[model samples]
Target: MGATKIDRARVADTALRLLNEVGLEGLTLRAIARELDVKAPALYWHFKDKQALLDEMATEMLRRMAAETAGPAPEDWRRGLADAMSALRSHLLRYRDGAKVYSGTHYTDTSYAEPMERHLRMLVDGGFTPGTAARAWFTAYSYTIGYVIEEQAMGPDPSALPSGAEAAANPPADPAPYDLGARATRLAGHPLAVAAGEELFTRHDPGFRAGLAAVVEGIAATLHPDGAKRGESGP
Candidate 1:
């Protein structure tokens, strides 16, 4: 395609694919231009620099996330917030180093406004003051983004162990030589330590969900200081 035909969407799409192949550090405007079979300068027509391209990429990802998560507004604003966050996490995990890429860039596009308004409205309807609603949305968003970044950093799950033959051919090295069993035994009298140890070393999904639940609960508590509670909304 000609340089004039190469729009920001096309550039962002190519950049996202390159991200999965080369990761965030390796992704560059030149790399995207190469992928498009064009000179590096051609990409500059759509994006001023790598940062501009990254911002567009982040905006595109969030655009898709907003679309996928959009529907009839939920009656329970907490549920709406939770579902929106879950969708955001799912979208970020769709690409390699996605959370890092997303966290590094800002969404400057007008497309971001709709979802932002929707989320803010949900929180406001949930009894939060306008300022508190904005804070609540960002607080949850920051938590999800930070959690996913750490989860991605840890690499894939060990429980998805390699085949027996593969394991025998290339046995994984034990970075932490301390026997978890023995450590658990030593801490048997301290239930809290044992639980904390287990949570620290295991797959992060359950813990992530638990933490997300706590965050939602905290938001709910803030919205409803009295013993009375809001009615649950249907999916």
Candidate 2:
């Protein structure tokens, strides 16, 4: 492929596909160029550096996420917030190290702006101040991204074990099963740590939902104390 034939979309698409094969650390510009069958210099025409390509990849991920998450906006702000965060988590999990690709990267397009505006407006309509609404979104976004990053690092399993590329990169010093009893025995020196291991390591799906609910509830109580009364006035 020549420089003229290669566009940002193709480069980003190729990068996303390579993510599953190489993981983020192994995903280099030269590697992407190899997949594209072009010289590494050819990619520079579309993206100046690896971060530039990552930003485009993240932007493309969000674009597909938005396209797939179609529905009537929930009338309740809490539901809207939770739904948005859940959707983001599911989207990030679709690719390997997806949250890593997305985190701290600049967007290549304004496509995210409109949906963000709507979410913030949803919070504001539910009686949160504009600043509070923005903060709430950031809080939830940060939590979801951080959670998925850790989750992916441990692979798709609920155990402390790493799988796939993660395992290949950093094998565990002492590999263990997904057994809570064994995990507790290993952490016996720290009683609290032992006690928490079960909840921390297993049942990730329920744990994530519970934590997200707490975050949403905390935002309501702390940022919008009069939210109930004010929300009653909303359509």
Candidate 3:
């Protein structure tokens, strides 16, 4: 058989698939090449290095997210902000180490510009100044990204253990589950911590929503107080 015709998209797609199988630490050019039925050097022709490939992968991930999360921007800035962020968090949680893969990587194309502009415009239309809108978006973005990083860290591999070099590169990041009884025992000295553990560790969905609501409210109260009232034109 002949070598598979490789392109940047092909490489990124393969890397993303391997990401769940091996994870970010274990994802390498050589492995991707093996999957592609090509030598590692052939991959370098498209992606100069692993980081370059990662950048492409991140871009593709964002592109997929944009495609999957299609809707009219909510007129209410708070709901709009929360909805946008919720979608982002959902997308980032799709792959193993997904948040890490997306965190620092730059988009390889202008595809991100449209979605960002649409969101910023949603805030601006809701009465925020352009600068404040950008800041508001960044605040939510930072919160969601940081939250997912910690979430992924808590249970890096939700399935099987890492094997071979994957194991060496990334020892299991799994932490002990802080159940109520365990929390009471392990954190007996700190009653508050023990009490908080249930909400903090065991209840991720509600906790995230509650925190996001706080973030939305804080932004309205602080950054653009009038924006919420103006934005309340829609659900």
TM per candidate: 0.76, 0.83, 0.86
Query: Model 2 segments beyond 4 Å from truth?
Result: 1-4, 157-182, 227-235
Task: State the lDDT at 106 in candidate 3.
Answer: 88
The per-candidate count of clashes, in order, stands at 0, 0, 0
The residue-by-residue lDDT of candidate 3 on 107-217, one tens digit each, is: 999999989988999999998999999999999999999998888777645345666799789965434454579658977899898887767675567778999999988
TM-score, candidate number 1: 0.76
C-alpha positional error of residue 34 in candidate 2 after TM-score superposition, expressed in Å: 1.2
Give candidates' CA RMSD values in order. Answer: 7.4, 6.7, 7.1
User: What is the per-residue lDDT of model 1 for residues 1-235, given as tens digits with 9 covering 90 to 100?
Assistant: 4444577888899888788777788898888888888888888777788888888889999888878877666878878888888888878876877898898687876988888888788777768878878878888999999988876665542333364799789865422334568888999898888767656656466777888889988877654433124333322
Off by over 4 Å in 1: 1-5, 157-197, 223-235
Could you say which candidate leads in TM-score? Answer: 3
lDDT of 2: 0.84
Q: What is the C-alpha lDDT profile of model 2 across 8-107, one tens digit per residue?
A: 8999998998888778999999998899888899888888888888999999998998888765567699999999999999788768899999999999
Weakest 10 consecutive residues of candidate 1 by summed lDDT: 226-235
Top-scoring candidate (lDDT): 3
